[model samples]
Target chain A: MDDEVIICRCEEVTKGEILKAIEQGAKTITGIKIRTRAGMGLCQGRTCGRLIARLLAERTAQVLEEIPPATVRPPVRATKMENLVTSHGE
Target chain B: MVNKADAVVIGGGVIGNSIAYYLAKYGVDTLLIERKDLAAGTSGACDGFIFLQSKKPGFDLRLALESTRLYENLADELSYDIEYRKCGGMILIETEEQLKAIIELVDGQRKTGLDVKLMRIPQELEPILSGHIIGATHSPLDAQVNPFKVVLGFAQGAKRKGAQILTHMEVQAIRTRTVRGELKVDSVITERGEIKTNTVINAAGVHAPVIAKMVGLDLPIIPRRGQVLVTEPLPDLVTSLLVDAEYITLKLAPDHRGTDGLGLGFTLEQTASGNLLIGSTREFVGYDRRTTYHGIKAITQNVLRIAPALKEVNIIRSFAGLRPYTPDGLPILGKLRGVEGFIVAAGHEGDGIALAPITGKLIAELVVKGKPSISLDEFGLERFK
Candidate 1:
């Protein structure tokens, strides 16, 4: 892959950026996410999560299945603050 | 895994890495062991607010002030861009009672040599804030940094200074021996092998009590969980580290359980990348670091109350971290009474990011010179007794 090719479309993180984070001892998707903001954007790693994980596995010489996914937090889908408030007590 | 070192620091969070760096710089043969990667716990999961005004008056504020000075020169000294930024901070005051309380708190802080003052909501923040937020307190000293970079910087700096750092190595046992009818840390037994060392610094954070238990000592540290939310990257919305005045009340008052028993508080910070890091709910839920639906709702409600304009902001995700809480809010630092060569520097709770550099410097000083320049009397482990 070309170094300039974008990996995380939401964040516009390039392949070079992901590679740099990997070189700096980012062994997991969470590590790469925090280091490069690759998967912390609108999709919250949904779009680019697997691509980055594969890159990490290939770079670290680990099996693709061995690479863990980035931690998925609440509000899995992007939701507005007002939506939460409007929902009220269930 | 070699066999020996002058000092063996346990846990590789911000605290442990800082201690390792300072020890190595002071010419101590330092070896640090981490169960996981650096900042994998609270340090990585928490926000990067090096806030001062919210600290309890006297010892806590004083230590924070000293730590601030160290943080100012840290990025340059460590030769790593920890993204240290003194963007300043503010506390949003809503109620008349909040204003009065903040005034009294600011007065006490000013007396402690902290440069802080109460002020009207600034022109920039006026549009975003709700009408209920009548006033604010601004301090030029409160700053922030990238917590991950800070931990990595310390670990790298320690390595550059010839200190040995071992990650993915869990300590199974703390080997100690009795000499002259007193307990002394002999070495640490890890999954790899036993490391021979006379001194052991416990910086295990929320798991500190577990480490202390290996030596038949019961530490009073409890895991207090805090949950936070992250918004999608947007144009600079709210600037600086902004918190609700009630956040201070929640932090200082132990009995004041917040909205729905979640201990909710509103702390807003815009990251360098323009993503707003909103937080948090403080709950004592043992070791569970899971975020709840109610916790998320409470924090969002708080954001809307503080900055109604943020009602439209889309939240990307929410996460939780466990803070090491003690009986008193202050961290447990300095040596233990019954143990020789055993020093503790954990239980910083939310102040871990703020106090990491100074804690490292002081603990290093305590090890090298047998005492820190500033008194550790207030932070001693025996205070629980």
Candidate 2:
């Protein structure tokens, strides 16, 4: 984990932050997601999810397949708050 | 010397990457050819929602369920983050008609052993949703991931396991041969040169139909365009993924404004970045990936009705991608009837991101071991015939 590199841009989470989370007892994939917000950033973890998962595996001495994959929810893009309000006005 | 391999997988989206990863993990010599970078198609553009609730009953639901399970373990197996979150999912019901439709969907889900429940009042939706809600149905198993990272992670893992990935390599044609009067796929003619291989897997996303046509196969795949909008970062306002059943119905409805023979559905998801994802419009505009104001407005209207607080969120950008749709709303997988060593793994439409893991695993198993761990007859190309 690089000290200068940021893992999650939205949360300012870094690779060190994620590795630390794993070291501190984040076992499940979601546990790491919550503690470090590694995969929770904009770009929706599209850039960092696999990277974090690899780091977690290295820290936990676990097989990659044993660690569950992240779940995907839809609207797969972000909607405008204005759009939500305006559409309802109709 | 040009290396020979057991399989050559075209396309490097989640499907192609996943197939390559699994095949290599199984110790098969595999070569993955991509026209551009990984996840360059719909996999790069759309939200990675591994949803099972909205699938049609029977075979579709069954396939989605199995795919969901595979997603659960993909992160560990691939050693990639993939941002997999099972924050659950909700379908908001604004009208009684929508509620009734949801009930039917719930019934269908239950028949397939899925745990889907309908909320009679808005109180039961408290933990899952915020703001106004008429009624809603909840599914604990629904989840999301970042599409780009997942595909790249698979590509990385496949490469690590001895799979050769050629980026910026486009397949110009599929070369077939007559060995003792029997036709077979001999190799692929690419922009670089000819690579002779025993097996060819078409995981080409929207461009799959073109590849299939090269082999004299009719895939019945059409390009269904979907538009999406991205907003600037905000607080974590949405905990679970929120969907409006009306939107799904409207998207699926034939007469909906955005459904230009495709569908009209808008989904709202808040990313870890504090930004929100509003999507999308389904139109049958062939390979045109441009976004339109009309489509954005329709999607915005739908989002505002569910969460009025979103009125202040700043929209930064919007984009669109093409979903590879089939006539029966199912993807074409497995080998075509007459084409030996030629496999089809396209037409997943919007569900490509959701079903990538399972699709890849199944295709790898079918190609390497002669059969998939699961029965792929339902997803086979024969369904079209």
Candidate 3:
């Protein structure tokens, strides 16, 4: 069902590539993480960003706080290259 | 996969590497593609604030005071280390109707000469702001930099003055012809092929109306978005560049609300590594770069209503960017009247990174001087007809 569901657990990104990045227009969720890199791995989308914002508010009928949640950046966990060579006083 | 150029440009952010660094420093033959990479959009989700104390006095505060005097000599003319900071901004005035609409916007940016003032903010200036402010303005020519080192210092000064960036690619159309009856624009079909180039500069930010509808032109340029956050590296707490003087009348309409509807407030800055760059929220919400939970809870409940000691900082990250907007917040910039060799630099919604180097030296003096050292008929595109 929907290619074994799995919508982006650290970029496994499914639900059939978020319905093929919503048939190629995406409409948001940072346009399906720039079209399917899906919340960009390494827990960046914090576990599939509210399940791809509830599958883009149930495929656009719009609901869940009006679908909006992609655009999370930072070492939200995972950086240590000695914090990128000491950005300053660790 | 044929190529050729006299200009192609498209978009690589920081206004397509400052119009491919002044169209290869006037030698032309530039290229510059990029579908991603190079501040992958909205110049890597902004907040550098080269702010001119919130423009809007006329010709958008005289083209933001000539792009704040070209970022005070753009890091020694692009030797590149865009940490460019002059540190002096403030704004605040948290209501008495935002101190009477920020004293008529610091008296229309001090009659457009700008040295703002209005003072009385000091609690050691930023001992974590929020003394429940009643006033504040202090311009000192507002500044800050590092929009990914100003798009890698204008794509390394347009590839050491030869130009031709081409990352990831993907343009796809804008071929045009007509010849005797008029029309122009010769090539640029990209997904990685045809180049040709008669001169095509869209600077596709917020996908400039899908690259001006591949040359037929119907540009209102939408996608407004915004949203931002980042903290973790404290210690300085937030020195200069504050902003929230009702975000210049919520950037003069794009439905950027806040008559208590969470006015897309604040535009804070502070980086140079000390983090704290919270920001923005000017929805229209088309190219949704997300981060909404009411735009990051109205930017941390409006940055803890002016830093309630930043409720123990540590936001770390959040973003969203897209701001091509243009419903008269200015920025259309020349061309599109009968098309001819296409131009239009792109709508500068939130002032495209403080007007990317005077819109790449006025689109490289309108492609090596066809008239444009200033006088873009109020940035036409037939003022959106």
Candidate 4:
């Protein structure tokens, strides 16, 4: 992949940026995610998590399976504040 | 990995990393062991407010004041851009009862020579705030920084100064030896290997008790859950870190019963990236860090009551963090009485980010000089007894 190629479309992180993060001692997917904000967008790494793991493995020469997936927090999908609450216009 | 170090600091959040940075800078052979990556715990999942006004007057407030002063030049000193913003802070008051409570709190803080005042919400912030918000307390000293960057900066600085930072390495056991009929820390045992050391510092945030329990000590630290909401990047909707007066009530009084078994506090602040980060609900769910519908709903309802215009803003994400709550609000710092060569620097709870620098400096001072400039007597583990 070219350095300019975008890996995380959600955050617009490119291959070069991720490689820089790896060089900065980010060995895992979560490490790269935090350093480059690759998987921190609205999608919350759903889209770019595997891509980031592969990139990290390639750069660090680690097995792809060994790299853990980035942490997933809930609402699994984005929900509106109004929808979450029950009482309306209090 | 080396078999020996002058000091071993456990955990790699902002607290541990900051301790490592200071210890390494002071010319100690420091080794930091983190179970996960840096800022992966409470430090990563929370807001970045260096809010001095919210602190209880006297010990806690004085410590925050000193820490805020250190943060002024921290970025330059660490050679890292932490996205520091000294935008000040406010505590919004909705009711006359809240106003009365805030006045008393502000008066206590003022007596300590802190530059805080109770006043109407400034005109610039007036339009965004709901009309129900009657008043606010403002302090120029309150500030914020990128929490992740701060952790990374400290870790990097520590590494530059020859500290060995081993991430993903969990300390399974703390090995100790009784020399001349006195027990002393001997080494830290990990799954991979044991690193021999005479000094061990626990800065593990909420998980400090787990490490303490390994050494036959019981730390009275429990995890209090807080859930926060984040908005999509937008124009500067809020400048300063804003919290409801009720948040202080929930924080200061542990037994203060809140609505629906959850302590909901309105904390709204716009990040440097332009996203308005709002939060939060303090609940005692016993280390269950999941954001529930009940929590999300409570927080949303509470926040909207203070800033109704934020209704249109899209919430990008919501997350939860476990604050290390001690019996007292203050952290358990300094060495334990029976534990030789062991020091504790955890249990800062929500104030960890604000007090990181001072905690680090004080802990390092205790390790190196056997005395911190600021006495840790009040903050020691003995206080709980």
DockQ of 3: 0.07
Q: How would you encode candidate 1's per-residue C-alpha lDDT over B1-385 as one tens digit per residue?
A: 6899999999889999999999999999999998877788899889999999889989889999999999999998999999889988998888898899899999999999999877786535446777667788989899999898899899989999999988778999988899999899998999889999899999999998888888878888888889999888888766679888778988787557775788888898888878888998778899998888888888988888777888888988898999998877789999987778889999998889999999999999999999898888999877778
Name every residue pair that clashes in candidate 1: none
Error of 2 at B248 (Å): 3.4
Q: In candidate 1, which residue ranges exceed 4 Å CA deviation?
A: A2-4, A16-20, A59-61, A88-90, B123-126
lDDT of 2 at B86: 88
- lDDT at residue B168 of model 3 (Cα atoms): 56
lDDT of 4 by residue, A1-90 (tens): 799999899889999999998887788887887788888777888888888888878878889998889766656677666665654332
Question: Candidate 2 DockQ category?
Answer: incorrect
A1-90 per-residue lDDT for model 3 (tens digits) = 567778777547778878776654355676576546576444667778887787777776678787667644544564322232224321
Residue-level lDDT tens digits of model 2 in B315-345: 6566788888787777888988777899989
Better of 3 and 4 by lDDT: 4
| Superposition TM-score, candidate 3 onto the true structure | 0.39
* Shift of residue B368 alpha carbon in model 4, Å: 1.0
Ranked by DockQ from best down, the candidates are: 1, 4, 2, 3
- Number of the predicted model whose DockQ against the real structure is largest: 1
Tens-digit lDDT string for candidate 3 (B53-149): 7777777788888887998899889887788888888878776777777788778778878887887755567778878876678877888887867
Q: What's model 3's lDDT at B63?
A: 84
Ranking by lDDT: 1, 4, 2, 3
Per-model DockQ against the true two-chain complex: 0.65, 0.14, 0.07, 0.48
For every model in order, the TM-score on chain A comes to 0.92, 0.74, 0.36, 0.89
